[model samples]
Target: MTGEAEQQLRAYVEYFRDLGVREFYRRGEPVFAVETVAPAVAVASALFAAPEPVAERPIVARKPDFLEPPIANPVSFDQLAPLPKSRVPASEKAAALLAVQQEIGDCTRCPLAYAGRRKIVFGDGNPNARLMFVGEGPGADEDTQGLPFVGKAGQLLNNMIAAMGLKREEVYIANIVKCRPPNNRVPEPAEAGVCTQFLLQQMDIVQPEVVVALGATAALYLLGVKRSLSSLRGHWHTCRGAKLAVTYHPAFLLRDPRQKGEAWKDLQMVMAEMGLKAPAKG
Candidate 1:
């Protein structure tokens, strides 16, 4: 082995020894240890010599299950009945979404859809608002009311907007998934995927100057980022050419009120982008 490689191997041995991992083999050969001797030997070797490169193993390919045909032939596409025409158009996706609401006035896309009698929770507020807030999904009150962010969390969101000198009507609000998840839980990745097009269409129609992701899920869906809220919050990012900011979901702030300070800081960042100062904390 090269001198550098030998040194690196020695360092690895020392590191593992420091972590109390002794009785290791060298060059694929087993070596017995009494106690401190084994560890010291490993560390000494690591410090003095470089590690040897292990030989590459041959890769084995496995056959897929589909290689063999099923005993029973499946129904052919031509034999199946055609699906109903989608009113949503490629260009007028927003209008199509509204039409979809009318069609499935009461939907059952997810289990939450059937838990309670629900009206279509079409998102409310300004369709032309400059700033839009996108959340994870709906909850009990929101599911029942057919709106996004209308529970205690929604109320807090309203107060947050008010603190920015605006009302709910002045900024649009929506969610990554329109329907609530079962038990008010976060929407699954599949559910978010099913509903994401509608959100993209909604943003296209609204053409908002900025978007605020209310939580990690919203940030991940809208911005394709998977950073912690602490890392993502209070910073300005961008998505689809619009300025983006992230903050703790109001629901989170409700549970951990201490985080409201950080949320307020994120809001100030949003306000600064709008050329307005956030209201001073009382």
Candidate 2:
């Protein structure tokens, strides 16, 4: 086969594999084992030959080598856990968040733990802030520094925060998964499932008044609904007792700069709700 054919074959195989067909076995016994169908006589003979008396045996279907794993549905942050009887006090929110981080120490609760992560990148910024930003997961720079959004995307995010007339330090930043997914692929649903348990706890403690989901994945898990970012954008959603807004991830805006204006519009909606105004241009 040529290279293109091989690629096409691989694509088909993966497509079938995704659909739960691992190996293709013969579907069923052939109509004729040794005889070729010869015209009308063969057809009539075969139709009449079904009268042969034979002992009946039970038909057993061969099972596949492995079953396709179940797809994990995204559960909204609120549905993940019940609200605490009482909210974490602002005076102790920082220490309470620290305790949550310590509990996640050297965390191996999810597969991302062993996916060559250098640090846990628990979260960053003010624990008691009324605004929070949630991204999908860490990148190379974040994994190295044990912080979220510290790379080029982070720079754009800082600019975005500045646009909102707020300092990055004034808001809490975190992700659905704490560790860098290998090669920065979207976190598997199972991985996000394991980590968001911790994330929900962080939200509960921080009790931010507003949350900005910085992409589809963040919006999906935060809102527990698989929706187009366009559908989720330009509207208010609720998460962890805070209003939520969805926008393109900074990384995506980096790839497609034209969308920055739309993202800014999303931010402006957030600013209006939070009583924030853009900084005066210098």
lDDT of 1 at 85: 34
**Candidate 2 wrongly placed segments (more than 4 Å):** 1-68
Best model per lDDT: 2
Pairs that collide in candidate 1 are: 6-49, 6-50, 6-51, 7-50, 10-46, 121-146
Shift of residue 254 alpha carbon in model 2, Å: 0.2
Model 2: how far residue 226 lies from native, Å: 1.1
Model 1 lDDT, residue 228, Cα: 82
Q: How many pairs of residues collide in each model?
A: 6, 0
lDDT per residue for candidate 1 within 104-211, as digits (tens), equals: 455444333433335545677776678889988888898778788989999999999999878899898988877765456676554565566556666665667889
- Estimate, for each residue in 170-236, the C-alpha lDDT of model 2 and write its tens digit: 9999999998977788877777877887899999999999999999999999998987999999999
